[model samples]
Target: MFLRPAARRLRADHPLALELAVLVLALAGAHLWRRGATALLPILSRAVRVDGLVTRGLLAGALLLAGLVLYVGVYALLRDIDVGLSVPSGRDRRSLGLALAVPPLLVGLTKLVGDLTGVPYNGLTMSAYGVGTPVPAVLASLVPGLLVGACSLTVVCQVLVQGTFARVVDGRRAAFLTTVLTAVVLSRSTGGLSAFPARGKLALAAAFVLSLGLALYAVEAVERDGVRYLAYLPVTAVLGLVVVSLIAATESVAELLFGATHVAVLGLAATSYERTHSLLVPAVAYLSLLLAEETVVLLFEAGMRSW
Candidate 1:
């Protein structure tokens, strides 16, 4: 059943084409958004200057609402696909879980290492400007972060789609290609975030390799020993500590919250996918969390300015 020829051909042809199209469209959308935001900055500045706390709050609320709407639309689209796809097999489930877990863990490790080594990990940042900045200026600061979130979502969706296709094709080469593509997509998506220092870049590279290794090991272990292999929760706990420590080390409460929310959402998405085998669930969950985090941070910054 896993190696059916019809499945192989369907996977080899249609999914690859669909993935390529999605990648092209996503890239185009991101590029256009960045450019359009840049062009609109002056006009936005004039129109939405945050002169008072009320305006700041209003701006925050508006952005949050917009984010929610976008997420809902995406979720609806993904839900349609979910209805058509079958639940994955046990092996596929394990593989998906590992795939989802690795990337965010690696990101957390890079952040921890960067903090410890005095290198700036630029993978994620909460604020682009100081509090009390004009509403447009604040919005401008958020634009890049939102773009980064969008880029990350695109990468995750592509990874999930490609990974599913690889499984359907039942080819080791396809799986390896999926892994490589995932790594590449993640590395590229970081560009939308801050610029890393030299050491930070090296740390990120190392983390990527380590994550890929861990993911491979986890999937193999699960395949060999079944779900019992996942019973080694202590190791997972230690990794969780690494992420928590980094979050605690953050300079401010807002930063801490943002980091925590980021990791939590990623982990939750992975777990949800593992249980449901619905890619849409994780995608929508992650997107919603991203939006919520952005909203909270924006509101927090506005509040700080008000005080």
Candidate 2:
């Protein structure tokens, strides 16, 4: 019962490497496409006429919707995740409750962390790179901003990265790989790594390598005791450092792997809250996170990640 509710359409027949490749290609292509296609963001950041805004908005929406449709098609082809395209059964209601609740909890706790830390981000760094901060613009227009967030986050991070990758890697390794890779991608996309001045970047890299050696030792010791989740404290540190990373760039291998974190987490979350392999749970969770995310664009970015 528990299993079906979350993995109804999640059987994998493709070889591990092939599945991994397909997932990476699909999501990367989608992100690259969205990054290039997002002309509306520029409009949002600055003033534009109503007619122009409407026209640009429509174009962006259509483009985003097309990408979403393409993602759904890929899921259907590769994982049979057609949202099950069916009516919910009696058993689904409990899962539905979880679908509604968990995302908010995740977002809230993350936001709380940011609040405690004053909600700093790559905002200053991003601005330096000529990329206007998106949170404020997103707030300015609820519908358009949300449309971008939902479609982008769902396809790139939640479904493909968090959901699909987890199917291949399991246990703490799943979380470890997920977190590490996500951190890498975020660092690239946000200039987290690049933000450091020349010497600082080298220092950041050295610190990371040293910390990782110690973490690997710790991971081995703790896992010997079985299922200890907190064993990856260093991984959390990596993600946190990414949050404080002061630079931004694009299309790095790290960024791609990072997107995988979103795929597995959201994929699992969405399916768990429903009795079908539908997008409802993941979609709603991500959408809600977009709203709740404000400046804490950690796990979910609503849509805009690179810029």
Best by TM-score: 2
Per-residue lDDT for 150-179 in model 1, tens only?
A: 434533333333334443354444434544
Per-candidate Cα RMSD to the true structure, in Å, reads 13.9, 13.0
C-alpha lDDT score of every prediction, in listed order: 0.43, 0.47
Error of 2 at 299 (Å): 21
lDDT of 2 by residue, 29-86 (tens): 5545556557555665355443566566665676666766675467756774323344
**Lowest lDDT 10-residue stretch of candidate 1:** 188-197
Model 2 CA deviation exceeding 4 Å by range: 1-14, 35-50, 71-75, 78-83, 120-140, 156-275, 295-307
lDDT of 2 at 248: 43
| TM per candidate | 0.35, 0.47
| Error at 270, model 1, angstroms | 5.8
